[model samples]
Target: MKQGIQAFISYTYTKNDVWLITMKDMMQWVKNPIENSHLTKGYWICQFNDKIKCSEQTSNSTTKKVTFAAIINVDQIWIWQTAFLVVLYIVIYRYDKYMQEKKKK
Candidate 1:
């Protein structure tokens, strides 16, 4: 029987929003100790609110094993966009109120 390596990556878009990635039985050669070492291992782009993509290769030697894990922190752009929408709603409500008052006069 042979032992396998497991790795995981977890990150938050905001204080509440979180995303996770996990790889089981991964090769040991691609292991990284950093929290968000996306560029260190290979050429890959990670986008916020997008599905994660992964690639790995194992060594020819069967004795040694390796694994890699990374967690990326994305900006809370969704939270900001929600706030802006709320402000716009308030402005529209106020405008409607002003128009109603003018028509009564």
Candidate 2:
């Protein structure tokens, strides 16, 4: 059971001590220049980090931090795609039911 569970939620930190539930945290960590330079080695992650690093100065204000967080949220493509799939499923299910009812009438 432990192995099975780990297979699904296996994303880990540098130390392997901390377990993260979302990719957003990983994305944020990858963007940090000092904290985890090793992670930026990946081509895609590096590109994403470069794109999201909107501000030049390292010391960002509260508003800038919030904006950065929002940008990260938006950049999480899988989350948006999953949400769209769920909505599409619901619409298709409802439409199927409506069609069945119309056929009965």
Question: What is the clash count of model 1?
Answer: 5
In model 1, which regions exceed 4 Å deviation? 1-74
Steric clash pairs (candidate 1): 27-66, 28-65, 28-66, 28-67, 29-66
User: What's the CA RMSD for each of the models?
Assistant: 22.4, 18.6
Give lDDT: candidate 1, residue 87: 36
Supply the TM-score for candidate 1: 0.29
lDDT of 2 at 71: 27
The digit string of per-residue lDDT tens for model 2 on 1-105 reads 111111011223335443322334344443443353322221111112312321112232321111111122444545544543443344335445555665699
Distance from true location, Cα of 30 in model 1, Å: 54
